[model samples]
Target: MRFIIIGAGRVGLRTARVLRQEGHEVTLVERDAEKADRARGLTFEVVDGDGSRESVLQDAGVADADAVGALTGDLNANFAACLIAKHHGCRTVMRIDEDYREEIYQQYADEVDEIVYPERLGAIGAKNALLGGSIQAIADVAQSLQIVLITITDGSPMKGYTLSEVALPSDSRILAFGKANDPLGIPLPDDSLEAGDRVAVLAEFSELTEVRQLLVGDESAAAAVAGGE
Candidate 1:
């Protein structure tokens, strides 16, 4: 897919790099001459103008873009770029620094296809690194729910059990499971739960402790693993 990114800052540059790595085309719009030149130095096709302006967007080929991301630090500019992208019939994605504004922006979310809080994502990553658990939080889905990746430990009671036999907590559900190094797949009722396998689960915060205890064994086991890290 073709994407137009409205910024040449860290997030915009990284996003373009990953999309390009996934075989997508990207054009970046940056008003800062130095930032635009830096992006160009990295071989990125950059439009040297303000992304919030229609004329600048037109120069970046917004009409031909499949999607446009307003990823600048400036929320007003991001919103403006998204509105123009929407007008051009392109999928719009807006980035915001503050998660506190999610509710306010969500009210007008129809203007953009997606709204993301990079700070919240960074918090999740940091939490995962600091929290020593068999279950590492991948995302906070809602106020009380989390998306987690649970690793079935070598000595876990979950080993040799099937999905249904595991009798997961009421507030938790297994999304997928497979070998630790393998991509997750649908958890068949009869599929064996092997040690070192990993499962992605959606779980309530309150139920995570029990969920970890069941799959990872005891607190001692969790502590030992943390100690080794």
Candidate 2:
């Protein structure tokens, strides 16, 4: 696959590197002389011009690209680049900054194939690391819903129960289960929960405490893990 990425800063360059490592063709458009030189220093093909300009994107081979990632920090530039890519029938992925108002975010979200908020994703990862323990937040599905990974411990109330017998809180559901040292998979009705087992659950934010208590137990252990860091 071929990709045209707008901007050559941290996010754009890192994304280009990953795509290139996977054997995909990548070209970056960077307006800044220093950034363009930096990307070129790493043996990347960079077009030196404003990414919002259609001519600049053409130089980066947007017409032949399978996808375009508008990853510049400038919201207007990113949106313009995505609009041009969409006109060329390319899949568009636009990056949005954390400072934008919710209404503006939603308006632009409807125009692109995908929206990425790097800061939000980074925060989620940082939070997981900080809250280390038997329970970890996997993702924020929405404002009110979250996906969490829970490890069954010795004191867990559900440790001796089967998947079919465990009753979770309202609006919560078990998504996947895994035995100790094994990869997670679809939950099985006959599978029994035991110490060291891991379970992935999707629950509303209000029900997370109950889910954690039922699956992990012993809150002090989790607190100790976080405090030790």
Candidate 3:
């Protein structure tokens, strides 16, 4: 696959390197001469110009790209670049920095292929830091869903339960499970949940509280359930 990434910043550069390492063709577009020169040093094809401009993107072969990631820190530039990429028949992903504006931009998410929130993910990291132990968010699957890895502690309601016997909220389901220290893999129906084992679950945004309560009995989960009233 050929990917054109706008912005030669940390996110764009690292994304290009990883894609290149996977044997995909990657081209990076940057407006700054210094950044373009820096990208060239990394052995990636670099285009020095404003990514938001159609001509600049065209010069980077956006029309032939399998995918385009508009990852500049500037939101407007990223959005404009994505529009151009979408017009050129490339699947597009735009990086958004503000969480509050997510819903407004998400109205156009279907027009593009995806939207990313690196800043919001950083916030989630901060949340995990404060929450400490047991529960950890793995990724935001969508605006209303999250994939999380939870450890089964001794007092967890899920501890000692079999995979087939655990009751998840209607909006949630277990995606995978594995014993602690084991290579993470999909859980089998016969597998029993043991203390120290880890489970990965996909839950709707509204059901996260219940899901957490069932797993770790966290106070926030209980509070959420109460507040839902």
Off by over 4 Å in 1: 180-182, 220-229
Give the worst 10-residue stretch by lDDT in candidate 3. 220-229
Best by lDDT: 2
Backbone clashes in each candidate structure, one number apiece? Answer: 0, 0, 0
Which wins on lDDT, candidate 1 or candidate 2? 2
TM-score of each: 0.88, 0.88, 0.83
lDDT of 3: 0.84
In TM-score terms, candidate 3 sits at: 0.83
Misplaced by over 4 Å in model 3 are: 109-111, 129-132, 181-188, 218-229
Q: For candidate 1, what is the lDDT? A: 0.84
Kindly give the stretch of ten consecutive residues in candidate 1 with the minimal lDDT sum.
220-229
Tens digits of lDDT, candidate 1, 1-229: 9999999998999999999999999999999999999999999999999899999999999989999999999999999999899999999999997877777787766878888888777767766677655667777777678878888877788888888898889989998888767888988888777877888888887777677778877743343222111
The C-alpha RMSD of each candidate to the native structure, in angstroms, is 3.8, 3.5, 3.5
Model 3: per-residue lDDT, tens digit, 38-105? 99988889999999999999999987899999999998899889888988999999888877677777
Better of 2 and 3 by lDDT: 2
